[model samples]
Target: MSNYDITLPLTREVAAQLRAGDSVRLTGTLYSARDAAHKRLNELLDAGLPLPIPIENATIYYAGPTPAPEGYAVGAIGPTTSGRMDAYAPRLIALGLCGMIGKGERDALVVRAIRKHGAVYFGAIGGAGALLAEHVEDADIVAFPELGAEALRRLTVRDFPAVVVIDSTGMSLYESGRAEYLKSLK
Candidate 1:
């Protein structure tokens, strides 16, 4: 229920301080990667190959942004369904990925990994891509450019809005909020 203004490359301390249902305006650096990029990263991990981006204390956004128009930092950078990345998320979290930004429910395995690793999962507004793009100060494709929109990109965001849907302790706002609403109806 509290609000936070946090910067990225989230440390264990920062991750632990967050709680489910908290509002956040995240600033600083984060990476964009959809399911394809996540799969590639997992393959690299499995093969003992170097990853395209640093894994430690990193925050990955589940977004495949559109091509920016003239003078824009990004275009329609809305969150993709986080479940698409669920298969690969635990491995990344084990490698020190401390935060994620997307929409919808996460799988049980992903939630467990977040709790075990002192990480947090944030939810972005799904249909507010144009509004979200305004907060992105910079964006550059960093790897897998061949994948176009699915390519890994580095984004610098300022006051990017999100809500903490799952906190480090494994509290899930989605579950709790839904239960509360259902209870209210009864």
Candidate 2:
């Protein structure tokens, strides 16, 4: 797999060049949100209200971190299941949301949206929250602080490791890798 060091506030040109199964070390500011925050964001969207954070050319990490330990910027900030955000992802992608960081596979509609918008989906390893937190240089609540861990936070990450789970072209490593494994056994 190819390894890429990408600096974010991601652009469509950058997103389009990435491919599924490629390893990436993403460094830059990204927003964080979970189910509760996503629900609220959708509510704002439905009302035609302004979103709390900028959606254009931005990557959102699907996570809700635990309380930070003494002297640490954040606690175990791990990826939430991506499927939980499926209902809202397509609309956001169409609005210029460029990338997503999460665990698990996305539905077909979300994949189609990513392809159409030239967006991407990155996978953060599950159960490695503590390790991942080490890459978080800084974080602060950008909105919805009342939701506590589920608050939408602005996170500045440095060399955060991830895999291209689904690329802008709609290619999915989950499907391709599984297919390759099955073919090998035949």
Candidate 3:
């Protein structure tokens, strides 16, 4: 595995170079969206309506942060379980979503879509919300204000840490790492 410092709005060229298990510190803009936001985006897509946020070359972080403390930009911002967003990922991937930041494993279909679309899935440290929030320089709700924390938010991050869980080539660190560990035990 290699370590990299990457900026967001990831392009295919940059994404294609990442491999499962690589460590990355991402800087730049990231969009927040969980299940509710994804559902709404899907609905908009079905209706042939313009999406609330631009999809092309976008990186969506699966998180619903708590209200910020008095002086902070954000609060306890951590990744939600990625599986909850699996159902909606492929459609978004097809629409040019280049990256995702979250925890847990994604389903096979999502993996395939990631590969087919030249995208990468990065896994954040799940319980490190407080630490993660420090990386967020700013946060603003871009859409769906009534959804509260589940609202779509644009976040500006600097040196946000994550690991490549799945790569553009369809490689999965979860599967590979598990197999390796099991083999070592035997």
Candidate 4:
């Protein structure tokens, strides 16, 4: 029930605080990067080029936001499917990315990798654009602007609401919830 502001170079204590099904209101600087950006990041890693920003203890939000309307910093920012980045996530985790914020369930391989490296996956509300946008106070593209919505944006968020879908221990709220429901049905 306690709230936390996760900053870069996250400590083990902070990572441990995040757990599946726990509601969290994250604040501070978060990086936005989706499937396309992930692909490019991997390419950069393979080429041994410096990353635009260090991923050490950083939390990456998997979203391809729509263009913000006039006067808004961002618009319709919602969590995209997390499975698309499964193959590339282990690389990012190895690079020191501590956690990820996105929607839906990730695969077993991704879950194993997340635990293997010490990272958490948060699930923000899916299809709640206006609600989610309210949390994003400011947004600016830091790199790969050419990718448009898929570009990486540096966002300052306030009380950004999210639920932990996968904790550092590899626990999954979605799967447990489904099992509970199915047990009730039986």
Candidate 5:
């Protein structure tokens, strides 16, 4: 496993270098954004209004985490399903967003966009909320704080475990894994 402290807006070369099933520990700032937030973000972008947060070269985690208790930055933060963000992802990536972290698989369209935009997608443990929360050392709302859990939070994380789901070369582990398994039965 390699440790990466990469900032978002990753280049094609960077995306191509990542492979499915590769273990990586990411450290740096991450932002939490979910469906509602994505919709609002798109609206803001489309209207020529400044985005609440600068997404360029930034990594976003799709989640609606539990509220934090006093003195804690967050509570039981975990990745939500990646599919819900499909509509907004390509637009965000085109705006220079570098990576996405979520649970479950992304659709083919998202994979293509990631490859085209020099971005990567990572999968984190879906239901492991407690364990995931421990990794978020600091967090603050950079956008839409009124949305509560659905608000966008800027977080500083350490040793966040994830696997590359899609790489810059358009390689997808989820598809490959399924194909390999199906072929074995033939």
Candidate 6:
């Protein structure tokens, strides 16, 4: 696996060079959203309405962070299961979404969409919410405030770490790792 120091707004050229299992420290802007927001996004798409937030060539984190404590920009913000967004990912990818951050393996459809769209999927370390929150320098609700913690948030992050779970080539660290483990058991 390679290590990359990426400053976001991840472009297609940069995203295509990433490989599954590569580690990255991403610094810059990203939007935070979860299942509730994704569902709403799809609904807007179906009705031919423009998205509330600009998704083109953008990265999104699947999370619902808790309220900030004291001086923190954000609280314990951890990734939710990536599979939960599977139902909505293809549509977003088709709209030029480039990167996604969350935990767990994605469904087949989402994987295929990422490859076709030249996108990347990063796997944030799970169960490290508080530690992850330290990387977020700022967070502001961009849309859907009624969803509470699940509202779409624009975040400024520094040294935010993640692993490339699915690269633009459609390579998957989850599948490869599982295969290697099985081979080792033989």
Between candidates 3 and 6, which one is better according to TM-score? 3
Residue-level lDDT of model 4, residues 1-186, one tens digit each, is: 345555544555687778777888788888999988999998998999988877887889999888999988899998998889898888888778887989887887788877988788999998997899999999999999999999999998888988888888999999876797899998
* Candidate 5 segments exceeding 4 Å error: 1-13, 181-186
Q: TM-score for model 2?
A: 0.97
TM-score for all predictions?
A: 0.97, 0.97, 0.97, 0.91, 0.89, 0.96
**Model 2 lDDT tens row, 55-122:** 99999999999999888889998899999999999999999899999999899999999989999999
Model 1 segments more than 4 A misplaced: none
lDDT of 5 at 25: 75
In angstroms, give how far residue 148 of model 5 lies from its true place: 0.7
| Candidate 1 per-residue C-alpha lDDT over 50-129 given as tens digits, one digit per residue, 9 for 90 to 100 | 99888899999999988899999889999999998999999999988999999999999999999899999999999899
Report the lDDT tens digits of candidate 3 across residue range 1-186: 999999888999999999999999999998999999999999999999999888999999999999999989889999999999999999999999999999998999998999899999999999999999999999999999999999999999999999999999999999998998899998
Query: Which pairs clash (backbone N, Cα, C closer than 3 Å) in model 2?
Result: none
The C-alpha local distance difference test score for the whole of candidate 4 amounts to: 0.85
State the displacement of the C-alpha of residue 163, model 6, in Å, after optimal TM-score superposition.
0.2
Identify the leading candidate in terms of lDDT: 3
lDDT of each: 0.94, 0.94, 0.95, 0.85, 0.83, 0.94
* Candidate achieving higher lDDT, 2 or 4: 2
Model 5 C-alpha lDDT per residue in residues 136-180, reported as the tens digit of each score:
889999888789899999988888888887777777778887898
Give me the displacement of residue 78 in model 5, in angstroms.
Answer: 0.9
